[model samples]
Target: MEKDRLVRFVGKVMEESGFKVYKDFKTSRYIIDIYGVLPTIVGDMGVVVACKNYDEHWEVGLDVLKEMEMIGKTLKASKIVVITTSYFTNSASNYAGRRNIKLIDKDGLVTIAKKFSKKENEIYETNVIDENEDSETYIPSTKSSKGPSIFHAGKRSLSKSGRSKSVGRNLNLGNFMQGFKGIMSNTVALIIIVLLLSSLITYIIGLFNKNTALIGVSKILSSAILSYGLVFYADRDPNVVLTKGTIVFFVSMIIYVVLIVLL
Candidate 1:
């Protein structure tokens, strides 16, 4: 029957993804056409396959997918994979997604199969995956950072390049904002610590020295403090340098004036 050829075809494709693939695999309840073990970074994940080669341009529907889902439940499979020669209907895909079933049509299978020009034993011997790393850079036993895709190859969604190398990656505005905020916070913290420490030292010096001497010292430090903020801010962007400099200048001046009057 057509189903037999489809099972064999799916088995061949699964082999490329570093699976020990077998056709007509039997479980406790029913006979699964294909079953395989996918070695991943987290652990070995089980894949149960349902292969269909339709005679017509039939859209594999949700009803068929539900059967695969039920079968997957019994087998405790990580992925319930449905591979078809014909394309899937929209409803079928939606339903499969809801059930967490992976769907692969004729084109996806062929593309995946072609990538496996290497012999199955060679792949088994060579590939090794380690702690949650990029599957693209995986050697022996690796899994994608995201979940597994329908194909054995990494499935970076919205990226048309499938297994092909891409020139760029998506920019994340949220991450950029978070990093910027952290830098600003650290800069402000450093300024606070430095200014506070300087004030404490000035206070101790004032306690020991005469008012005239303290006033002279304060004046010199005040000029330096004012210029420090300006110079610190001058190089970078519109960072918190201006604010830091202003605070340092004003605080030093207030301390300087207070000592001159009180002493």
Candidate 2:
């Protein structure tokens, strides 16, 4: 049988014997081969079986046997059955005998499976943590009744380091509405603002004068500034400024400078 079919068969046997089975039981990173909760029905007991599909005559390794033994004890299982198509090594059999784990070799599996084909009664209980509780029920170790220990200090310190880290987060979220409005507005006044700023800065740098270079640079800067305003407006709408947008702007700026200097 396929692994899943074999597991299903084992689980069916367990259920018939009156046990609650939990398949793919994750104790840690790896899932247990077959972890099940057996009902406490008088003489009929539940089991956890680490099922293996190896060929006959192959011996079950001691380490594999030990790991399953530990998991069985941890889960409070009455018995752990290493159900394999293969027989157990002498050391593995001795260990299982001492630990009280039942070995279900290929032949034993079919026999035992046929025996536990009836369901039994089981008791189930669960624990839950209460979220809403007064001080009478659950209290923090800290003596202060004001609030949580972490927020014990009276005021939030707005120091240089704190503000520096907080500024980026606050700007991204708190100023979102203001930034969105500024980016969307098509007031030509905003375009004029960018144009005037760029032109005045270039002029102050002595990069522009009464010559053709001055006029040419001014026009180029003015065009870029105007485009930036349009880009900002488009950004507010569904109009996207892709990754290429910044590259295009930078390249245009470089070309404009080279044209003024050479041509």
Candidate 3:
């Protein structure tokens, strides 16, 4: 199965199992393929799911389980389930067993497909798995249910489509604001802003006082600030700093000479 379809299939399975499912659930640090919550008498249990649509030969590794474990901890998930079209490595299986994480290999996937076929009256081509078969098999479902399309899973109460739309808009706005804040907070960006503002303010003050000296001082300050910025950029990429700094140096010198002659 394709990765996207596998995610949706897993989500549908979760929904069928009495859990509220969310597709492409985004967290602060990670994007969960399928997030589910199963409510019980005690409390709601969070389930973090990862879907891997690998070839039969390619086995899911220990690193994938470790990553899922970290994601589960971040989401405070009660259960971590990994469903893969392929099998799992021995180390991965051992780690999952120790961590109490549920791993569904190709055999388990076939079993799930068979169950869904029986329950939903859908036909699956890979009902029986042959040990000797080398080619890949897909379980196609005709079920119209697309599962949950929302990025977030909330209370069990059914919310209107308008609410989901609003939530999506809010999330987009929030992400844009966050990105803006990050850019503004960057040290290099702040330095550039300061250079522009200081140059403008100095020019204004010089004009008001009718003092050429203040304007000269402003040019000097701007050059110093530019040099500092160049030095900072040099730490990141020296080639960029060299090219830009050389051009800026000549340009500043020409501008300063013109100002001296004109003033």
**After superposition, which runs of candidate 1 have C-alpha atoms over 4 Å from their true positions?**
117-263
Misplaced by over 4 Å in model 2 are 41-46, 113-263
Off by over 4 Å in 3: 122-263
Tens-place lDDT per residue, model 2, 18-134, is 346778778754577676553221222335678788777667889878888677657655456787866778898777665546687777766554333311110011011223445
* lDDT at residue 125 of model 1 (Cα atoms): 34
Total clashing pairs for each candidate: 7, 3, 0
lDDT of each: 0.57, 0.52, 0.63
**Candidate 1 residue-wise lDDT, 108-196, digit = tens:** 76665554443343334333323455757644312212111244333243332332231112112222332333332343444444456
Which pairs of residues collide in model 3? none
TM-score of each: 0.45, 0.40, 0.47
Deviation of model 2 at 132, angstroms? 59
Error of 1 at 34 (Å): 0.9
Candidate number achieving the greatest lDDT relative to the actual structure: 3
Clashing pairs in 2: 16-118, 16-119, 18-120
Instruction: Give the distance in Å from residue 29's predicted Cα in candidate 3 to where it truly belongs.
Output: 1.4
lDDT of 3 by residue, 40-129 (tens): 543566778999999999999998898888897687675688989999999998877666378989998887776565545421212333
For candidate 2, which ten residues in a row score worst on lDDT? 118-127
